[model samples]
Target chain A: MPDDNNPIPHWQRQDLPPMLSRRFEFETYSETRRFLDGVAELAEAAQHYPNLSFGKTYVSVTLDADGKKVGPDLVALAQQIDSLVAGTP
Target chain B: MPDDNNPIPHWQRQDLPPMLSRRFEFETYSETRRFLDGVAELAEAAQHYPNLSFGKTYVSVTLDADGKKVGPDLVALAQQIDSLVAGTP
Candidate 1:
């Protein structure tokens, strides 16, 4: 069942890979770059690095779980990533 | 025949996608981040963005040609990317 109050709404949970993944779209490359930079800083601070793939106007981030299940720390990281673009102009 | 003096030696030429692609490895995430930042700056200056996929210690970059064949400009961009790590400590 889907959680009605999911903290990380944008991310898709994958069981096989045991990861949370999300693709963020932007209108311009500059916007994408800014978002990428924010993610980098967050990763550095959290000491949790995610796999990132991007093109001119999009970034796909994948957070892999250390074990078989998605943990609270990973969820928190996803929430932080979501907040990177939330309420931004 | 492969050119003996290929300027973009690090990149592999792909015909189906008409792209040049390469993978760069790093000992640490910080090194990968620095290379990514350099690529971002180069893309902004050259106005040519490449598809980038990275993990904690490696980045894979792909430059898609506008037409069916890879052009001189794309090759130049690849060379410039090569220089981003050349002779770097």
Candidate 2:
């Protein structure tokens, strides 16, 4: 068994793309809204939208399918949106 | 930036906790049912159970809130039962 102290590290945002489902954490409401807008654009293009739940400072999204690849693709899109938010673009 | 070929690793079953929400995948219907049973026991005990969606061979659960600690504590309990299934007990 993995040791408790040695508990595995959470999958970083970069690693989250390929999950079966995803939940994103953000720093503020505008950030959260902006991320959703980016995802909305992708959804409009690919027609592969996800289920969304918005919180005060977070947004949780789950895909319609459980395929391994679906999670990460959506995560990647979200990360792209995040980069747009971070002024790294 | 990370490479696409070297995509970040998916959060292992072990590292999934401490997340605000969680989703679990299993190998078989029996296995999925069994895991849900274990979670049920914990829910009965803690009264902090989650929302559940039982698929053919997978079960997805999402928490009511987006708190970090809740994700991992529950994941830890699920791991205990997973170890039991793996003959590690």
Candidate 3:
């Protein structure tokens, strides 16, 4: 059964040399689609992409490279995504 | 510092809705290179690639998708790579 949070079901994490992975999500289909495009742009710009898999109601990404800006990309988006999924932010 | 096993240095683990990560390593330049190409092929075939970073002496991969086969690709290569790195296989 797929839900809004676990888009990449049957996924497993691996220690990527020096990289870590965090999953992100959104509330609605529109929000999820927006996030997909925005993140794809960011990854293309930074030359860093994640293990991305999406559904109509949800989206997720797993980090696997040298995340360039922890402060700007990872920290900001993680918090934002967390809030959306949890209904707090 | 950077050894063979921990290639992607600043990595952290996140709860991927339903994902887990395990690291794999290899020894020697040629061996590492072979493993890289082979794994890349598997990723391409399975449509599931790992977070890859390389060095002169080692290679590593992090899983982030529904691993095609716990019995075939993932299991076979993971064990082979590990044995090569640990000097046991």
Give the number of the best model, judged by TM-score. 1
DockQ of each: 0.90, 0.03, 0.03
Which residue pairs overlap in candidate 2's backbone?
A17-A71, A17-A72, A18-A72, B17-B72, B18-B72
Q: lDDT per residue, candidate 1, B1-89, as tens digits?
A: 76889997778999987999999999999899899999988888889899999999999999989656999888999989999899853
Taken over the whole model, the C-alpha lDDT of each candidate is: 0.91, 0.50, 0.47
Cα lDDT for residue B73, candidate 1 = 85
In model 3, what lDDT does residue A18 have?
A: 37
Better of 1 and 3 by lDDT: 1
The digit string of per-residue lDDT tens for model 3 on A1-89 reads 55666432333434434333544545665575566557545555555545454543445566654634333454444444344445432
Q: Count the backbone clashes (under 3 Å) in each candidate.
A: 0, 5, 14
> How much lDDT does candidate 2 score?
0.50
Model 2 misplaced regions, further than 4 Å: A1-19, A66-89, B1-89
Task: Give the per-residue Cα lDDT of candidate 2 at A22.
Answer: 45
Compare the candidates by DockQ and give the number of the best one: 1
Which 10 successive residues of model 1 chain B have the least lDDT summed? B1-10
State in Å the error of residue B21, model 1: 0.4
DockQ of 3: 0.03
Report the TM-score of the second chain of model 2 against its true counterpart: 0.52
